[model samples]
Target chain A: MEKTWIANLLPQDEYREKRLLYFIAEAVFILGVSLFLYLMVESFIVEMDMPGDRMALLCIGFLITYTTLRSTLTGIEYPDVASEKRYQKEKRLRIYSTIHFWIIFLFISILFKGIPSNLEETFDIGGSATFAAIFFFILNYLSLKKSYKKNKDLLDD
Target chain B: MSLNNDRKIRNRIAVLRAEWNLSQKQLAEELGVSRQTIHSLEKNKYNPSLKLAFEISLFFGVALQEVFQYEEEEA
Candidate 1:
């Protein structure tokens, strides 16, 4: 019988190995992004001595969205055409829940931080960038949870 | 668990799949799994779930007992 490429893409391991690989990959990705952001912010501070970065915030927002979506989508598997409906349900639930948490957490953080002293100017740029990181961090948790849920659902069904 | 009589078991799977006039893709889709699963099953590299076993039986128009049989092989 001919092999479909999808099967090769599927995570093939017991739960422990799968979880370990997932967390490791997540940590690596987060570390890479954090390092890049640290360098960029440091360079901006050193060179321009700017109070905030509008471009960087926009770039970070897009990067976080793209990475979160890509990683989350890659891990999903449907048993058959009949399962697509259920897959869609699970996908929606996972994504919406993530978004909800992101928004809530952002507001909570802003309230706790009591707005930066340079709110008007900084918010026009750096504020959103900070929010983007928060969004991605929350998304990381959501994606990890979704991955585990996918495995559990498969075993259950 | 390992195959009790590996060679004959391998031969049985090939025979069954061929007799049904089903392609690997078709069988995999019918089984609600990826094509690699069918290949692995054919190669005896992976075991099927009970649900998968029932589906195979239904697909081949055979009882599970007919599709898979245990033959004790002496060392």
Candidate 2:
């Protein structure tokens, strides 16, 4: 006999709907954490006598990181391609897109922000952006790998 | 369902399920897959893996060729 709790939690007949609901719940949780982080950053900037614009930049960075992490963790099944190929394509697309976006962002920043006018500030922005990009890319790769491994049996190929 | 392309892998799963007096949900449970997967297979929108194909043939006590046929266009 199937376990009652498991049946109730994941009714086999409603598997697709349940999966969608789980994804939404996860997205909400991620959003909540990001909001909390934004508040903490706001308080930190105020305490440090930093500029208000810094807070906005940090929040944007945090949102980008949160979005990348969420996509990595969600494991939403791709409907088009088979399993392994789909995961590989997803991983490649994610890394490439993140890198492309960051490059554009850096160019825009350098153009508008005048290259920070100092060696120290230039290093700070460049180093932080590079670190964040690397961190996001790695997170995406590992998460996709894990999801692919876990769902191998469920997928078509 | 109407045959769309000569390159498609044709399956008789719906007919077999009817003969066995099984619903899509029951067949999916027996095959250890989602009901949606069974529906997709019946509609020929998704191809089953080799293991799944073998399992289906085994479950129905029929040859694999009897359950699945690959149709090709004539020259």
Candidate 3:
């Protein structure tokens, strides 16, 4: 009866396996984000005039926010309660930072009364904020990437 | 880094459970593990945690060495 009881409840093995799968998912997610960043830089930022660059920057910022939110909302089936909590905390921090970037980006893009006619002067104002947003998003993305790698290594054992 | 022993300690966990007159569902309930876990262990496809090992030993009233063995490391 006792043996029969035990046979019906296998907790440890299942949890370990779930942890492994979660790590795999996290790695794939981070790599996907990195690839998207590469694509964004290549296609949108490399060779554009001031207004075009600003528009491209805004689109990229929105893209980052959208992807981060989607991933956070769907990360629940991630092994165990402990892992889920850690993921949520990291996701929450990333969300906060990215939102801060979004607000700053929006303010600059929208609040400026007009684009300066002089190309260099316009770039001084517009380019700085655009670059700042890019840096912020990169940092947040790297944080997620690092967390995914660290957890993946731990779970592999 | 790896298991040093060549001799494998085989088990008949399912057979033993039957001889002791227990069902998979009943053992699963008592051990706080899933029936799938028991099935995996019985099939030698999964390793149990130390806690589970101790519990199983206690339930069977046998030293853990009786259920699991370590062949002396090859010199």
Candidate 4:
């Protein structure tokens, strides 16, 4: 059914190749910019003799929150991957990850002789670490639920 | 196509789309897939699942064999 056209789009292979090149260019640009920003901030902090702990925490927290929000709302897929395929793959990956995390956590708890109830029974992990772990787990679970909800329609498609 | 996959699939989607004067975007919308997927199919870079393969041939008003060719890898 080949028809002549006065004007036409690029061939499919060329289109995919060009799209991949664009993605690479963008990714490289983003990485370079972020690195530059990080270096500038770090140099400033070092010159000011500022304690890096709080800054590191803030940066990590901000990145985590930003990524979680994005993934939860938008769903994460590669540029060329289909949303429905991504939904299916992500669902399987999440399940596997959760199971692996729990298995490791259980192993750690058993090694530590049951989970600590209070600071006195620290089990070598301080209160903050435990709290952070629980918080992270809850956030992860919530994000997965949101992702599933956002991508559920992809299944029908 | 997967890097390690031995099966080779080639399809005449580009031919059909060109014959129909359909753009990648148009075929993608008609097939309920992304333009990138159509591109991949045309390039033989990705193998469509049986369901998708059938849908594509059906959309082109062609038989499955007319649309898709399967080749075995040399041992």
Candidate 5:
């Protein structure tokens, strides 16, 4: 019966509002941690040798991954409705499958094409990976929007 | 709640919960769903699947029809 801090923070009655708040809170928390890590890496590990652009890319990649993972895992749920939940789960699976397919395809292609043999090529591979990550994150966001539209009736306030 | 075409399923979960002396949290726990889900069900803001519908009926020891009423609009 005792409410945890998170439970207390979340809206009790409004499902949509609660989910939105939770997502924002999660994003902020992740971004904050990523910023902290970036600072640590720049100060300690990489020191002065690490380029600013590379550091920025690392932070961006972490944020994208965190957002995508959260969206994929915490799907739109009409928890009382098993079918809706199942539908959402299937949609999430499809999105994840698409993402996995692209990542694997990229990996295999890069492998067959041979590992980036130079610093420039290595940066190219990193850039490709970052682009792919952003693409999938956008795909997930769009998918979530589509699903929301489909089930708008069920999610009425 | 509005009796619009959008509201396909109407339920008496709130009344039943009251009759059963259970809070939304308690019923949600019993039904293995979130408290918000129970609230949504009571407010007729969500429609449960056949499986969840049956589960709810079973829990209440009532027929499915007793728990929910379907109001299909004329085409």
Candidate 6:
């Protein structure tokens, strides 16, 4: 049962040989998330002084959030390569993620806005991150569109 | 491991599937693989492991060479 679950963690097209690696990765992932969560709760909610600065914690939190979300996505299934529903879902999620990313950045900047006139520097950094995010989003969208076209040909032939 | 591998394997999955009157999803179920895998095989997007290749040929009741052909690398 445990093995079955681990094997299922991979997409259907993936090799069963990856199950062991996937299991180890899952264990490591759980441990890392638990450590991070404990540190975050202790440092912020519990108001305890940890070793690192809050900025470090913030950076770690953002990285975990971004990677965790991406890790969950297995990308398009082969059968749905050029399906309308699949394309629509991809498009929708692209917009949703871009908006959410900007929202998080803006929120963080506003939180820091409460501090010093460091507002200018913070906004500039936010602008750079947002600019990168937008470019990444556009690049993904264009490639995905191209893939849909190609996949259609694959299915047709 | 990646779609951009220089070596490619060509297969007659689509033709065989058609002759068998089997859809990609049905063949996937028979082969204990995903429909996506079936589609990938038909499109030459992936090269199955040796075990899977043998299983596929067996399932189609054909010789391995009849089902899959190795394409020489381009110079």
Best candidate per DockQ, number?
6
lDDT of 2 by residue, B1-75 (tens): 976676668899999999999877678879887655676688786787787899899999999999999987445
Candidates 1 and 3, the one with greater lDDT: 3
The alpha-carbon deviation from the true structure for residue B20 of candidate 6, after best TM-score superposition, in angstroms, is: 2.8
Highest-TM-score candidate: 6
Report the number of clashing residue pairs per model. Answer: 0, 0, 25, 4, 0, 0
Q: Estimate the Cα RMSD of every predicted model relative to the unseen true structure.
A: 13.0, 15.9, 15.9, 14.6, 15.7, 10.9
Instruction: Write candidate 1's Cα lDDT for B3-51 as tens digits.
Output: 5454433325557877777766576666666554565566665566566
Docking class of 1: incorrect
Runs in model 2 lying further than 4 Å from the true structure: A1-71, A77-90, B1-75
Give per-residue lDDT, candidate 1, residue B8.
Answer: 37
- Cα misplacement distance, residue A143 of candidate 3 (Å): 32
lDDT of 5 by residue, A60-155 (tens): 777666655554455443333324566667667766766786678579759876788899987787677667766765666565655454444444
Tens-place lDDT per residue, model 4, A47-129, is 54446897576656665555445544443222233356665675566666656665666567657677667767664454434
Inter-residue clash pairs, candidate 5: none
The positional error of residue A35 in candidate 3, measured at the CA in angstroms, is 6.0
What is the C-alpha local distance difference test score of each model? Answer: 0.56, 0.68, 0.58, 0.62, 0.67, 0.68
The residue ranges of model 5 lying beyond 4 angstroms of the native Cα positions read A1-109, A134-157, B1-8, B19-26, B32-39, B70-75
lDDT of 4 at A155: 30
CA displacement after TM-score superposition, residue A35 of candidate 2 (Å): 9.8
Distance from true position, residue A30, model 5, in Å?
Answer: 35
On a 0 to 1 TM-score scale, where does candidate 6 land against the true structure? 0.48
For residues A1-157, could you state the per-residue lDDT of candidate 6 as single tens digits? 2347655655555532343345446655775797788888987789666567775676566655444333333333233446799889988988898888777766776686553357687667678669867976775676567656645654633
